[model samples]
Target: MLQHLLRLSYPTPADHLDPEDHFSTALGTIFSDDLANQHGDRDALITYLPSTYPAYPAVELRLADPAGEDERRKFAHYLWNAGVLMAELWWLGREEEHKWRVKGHAVLELGAGVGLAGIMSVLAGAEEVVISDYPAPEILQNLRSNVERNVPSQLRPKVRVEGHTWGDVTSPFPAANAGKFSRILAADCLWMPHEHANLARSMRHFLSPDEDARVLVIAGFHTGRARMAAFFDVVGDEGLEVEEMFEMDAEGKRREWRSERDGGAEDHGERKKWLVLARLKRKTSINSGSA
Candidate 1:
């Protein structure tokens, strides 16, 4: 892990994907500017063990639908701050003001670490929700544990834990599932530039072809703003473009998305506090410069 002074108010989980030779059992504690915005939980101290994850979503916000995690031996490697933030977006928005809607929609969570956002979808009234990650027995097992523990028995039938490799065809998710999800959630999954093409392809594969179908994307700038930019470009190549996008600071202030930004790759302190969120849709003839 990157060695830095972790002056944590509350833990924001870190999305560490790279396999490491020497790994520590340290559960990263992060600042919760997001928690403060959604609820008054900024000062809550986080306590996480090797087996469990951090940032209790219930400490501050109340669920729209009361919903209700287990991995004992293995450390959760993919749970990150963006996943929590995504969950917050779905769960925290006031009923009258929520633009990020999941209720009564088919939802998919890509690279769903700990399946936080997907669980929130279940709680928020998604008609059906699929929480998927890389096809690993332990990871899928952990995801199942989280979903079963959180979602109510009545709502349990609405959620499915599936092991999925992105950009795959007709293996994990059946052919019937193509273009099935109206809302696809991707948080902190764009850290790898090399996988950008595959990620874009998968988004194109699963996203609904309808005008209302949308993909929700969020990623931290800790993985360089350039990588995030490259992801947009690749998605465009796959016929998906951002209908709306913006940069948000750790303080919850939002800004316009720009191609250029200072200190995104250099200034460590400022960049770590920055992330981008976007809504994507399939390109149409109207958006393809029909004149």
Candidate 2:
């Protein structure tokens, strides 16, 4: 089954707008002792997941000057983990040749918090990749820096990184990006309860006209299954389809751990990750046989 990731804010009888969507800083915030403990035991400089060979160096997403450095670090750290985990799973699916079938094609990524998917696409052989975020100038600046900092000069292809708000249509895309791109990738971008409409609109804009254009998305369960249903409804209304899905093990970790408490502690609904391969539907040509 195709699972819906990050559907925590789908509409109900009385759904109110979430201020975080509008007023939250470009670098969001989070503070949890559990996350901090995880960071401390490991090298804060860089780390890579075990599965990906010739492993890519890790990058941390940090909150920009929040009330306290401690609080800001938590949010930034988890955001990076989300991106890394998503990329790792996608790469695992394509490990047969250690390259992507969509290589050498134009690519675009939305809501790229730490640029993991875009970076991975380049590593997998994209001709040119554009990393886009919200219009917030500062946040966009950070995204650009990460693309440059983390992307090794040798492996980096012709890449352009920039920020674009969800609803803005006039923003400039790469010349080849006018209607090109064999692949479109995103992860953990659907969580904003209040921004589903805006997100749907943006996906339609950046999505390619080729009905077979490849799109691989991995999203975690944010607000449980109800919220996910709403996101799927939005996607269906916009003419996209979810092709496949996977779920993580208990404790929100990507892999299973052998521990006694895990036996009955798992909530089947919240432990899954939705991996979707979707594409935009092409409009019928007036002279086509079907038409």
Candidate 3:
């Protein structure tokens, strides 16, 4: 029994196939010092290890998701292989305005698929971070466990995680979150056109109206420019102003591309635009008296 308890093991990269093979292969292609060569100083943006497995397999089943531990384990490997979470970590670590260095700012993260961006923000020094997504039982269960697993010992005590469903307008913000967040963040969340209205409304309801507040949206422009333009257009009419927008290339360098809404287009449409950072500002209340 003692020996069994002491046994430790983790699967190798070649051991499993993700549901999306291409994404998994692409992730394997980008490992290790490759990131340093790819992004230069920005290499510090993500933390990647040769093998995510423990040095020796020790029994720490507590880290496993009780509800869907198997499913969560598979998804974790897939996410690692595709470098999906790494992408968010890389983008959020930058010290620029779009980055998570907004310390002392209370933040809410929507559509926190796997909770990467929110966790990264806490690492990047926000005062408080809340990670939220739809309340589907399985997803929420895995989300809670993942947050518990990844919350750094140094930072765990500072971060919080909870369930939020964008589709439910009547569902109140978690009491701990009500009117408290000064910044809202979303990454790679606009790809689902079906969720656009709900995502936009959720943003409007929670984003702080204080002039100094900011809502940053970071997404990979894999779906083409037209759809991206339309999403922002719908949100614009609701008073979320796009303060600044910039495109980032595969290597994570800023590049020049005409925003479709701005009547601009990239001269060469070959390279993939891996990221877009949009800072959203809420409209000031005209109905309120000035200080």
Candidate 4:
């Protein structure tokens, strides 16, 4: 069954208008013990699922240093995203199912900004999880640090961090890893419309050939519906079929998000950002014949 997972709205810090700063301040307060007192740009610790997993323990994440005024990396310091959080919650909710899906399987995460989804996958019992992003030294280094700090020692061996750029199929690492992943995850990666084809090519190259192998994608609607639709179109051209798609509103309402059109009447207010989630699988000859 298709499920739309919604993120609960919380009050933002009024002092910081930047979403990243607001998130950092709010998270620091929530996970005070993990916050360091260093004054300069340093890592901040945030807790995930503090209430529910108190015994097993809330996951501690050491995020990358916040972007400075002249920071060249535009997307690295943005530690939090509604879609990624929603995807994490969805996986946590279906713990047993996810464990079954990932157990003894290879998993890969693209555009793993803070490594949350990939970290969660490792914790959920994936045989191996490769977390990847743009090949910026700072971004890659921070990603490695997060995986090292948060993931238990026993599971750390199963997680690896790599530097990957979209559309580089000829690269040695990607060429070697081609069709090797049973599961692929991408959260908030469709914001850039120009990168749609490149992202789709990467997905095609990495996605395993098995019928059950799948890719899970989640994105916020802030980038506009047209751009999101274009991404799906490119993915379709790359031979992936959307098995299920849905949207979740701030009120936790779940509704089907059809792939047929660009715009809808869905509210995009400050508190009403919609999350679009989809499960995709390779299109087989039989499925293509039917289409």
Give Cα distance to truth, residue 91, candidate 1, Å: 8.6
The digit string of per-residue lDDT tens for model 2 on 98-195 reads 23354677777877765667776677677878887754555566566667776778866577677666656555653324446556666666556566
TM-score of each: 0.72, 0.62, 0.66, 0.76
The segments of candidate 1 whose C-alpha lies over 4 angstroms from its true place after superposition are: 1-76, 90-98, 172-174, 263-265, 286-291
TM-score result, candidate 2: 0.62
lDDT of 2 at 161: 76
Overlapping backbone residue pairs in candidate 1 total 3
What's the number of clashes in each of the models? 3, 6, 2, 0
Off by over 4 Å in 2: 1-46, 55-81, 90-102, 154-157, 174-178, 246-291
* Tens-place lDDT digits, model 1, residues 113-228: 56778887887789999988776666677678677667779999999988777777567474658778889999888877877887877887888776688899988876577877
Instruction: Sort by lDDT, best first.
Output: 4, 1, 3, 2
What tens digits encode model 4's per-residue C-alpha lDDT throughout 1-291? Answer: 111121222244444356674564455457543321111123345555522354434455554653454333446555445434433544334643552266577999998877877887787778999999887777788889878878899888899999899999888889899888988888878878888888888887888887678887877666567667678877777777778777764344667785433346544443125667778888764243221
Q: What's the lDDT for residue 223 in model 4?
A: 58
- Model 4 residue 153 distance off true place after TM-score fit, in angstroms: 1.7
Candidate 1 weakest ten by summed lDDT: 59-68
Q: Candidates' lDDT values, in order?
A: 0.64, 0.49, 0.52, 0.66
Question: Model 3, 28-147: lDDT tens per residue?
Answer: 246432221111010011233212234312112111222455434322211211123222333434465344345677878876655655665675677888877665565556556666
Best by lDDT: 4
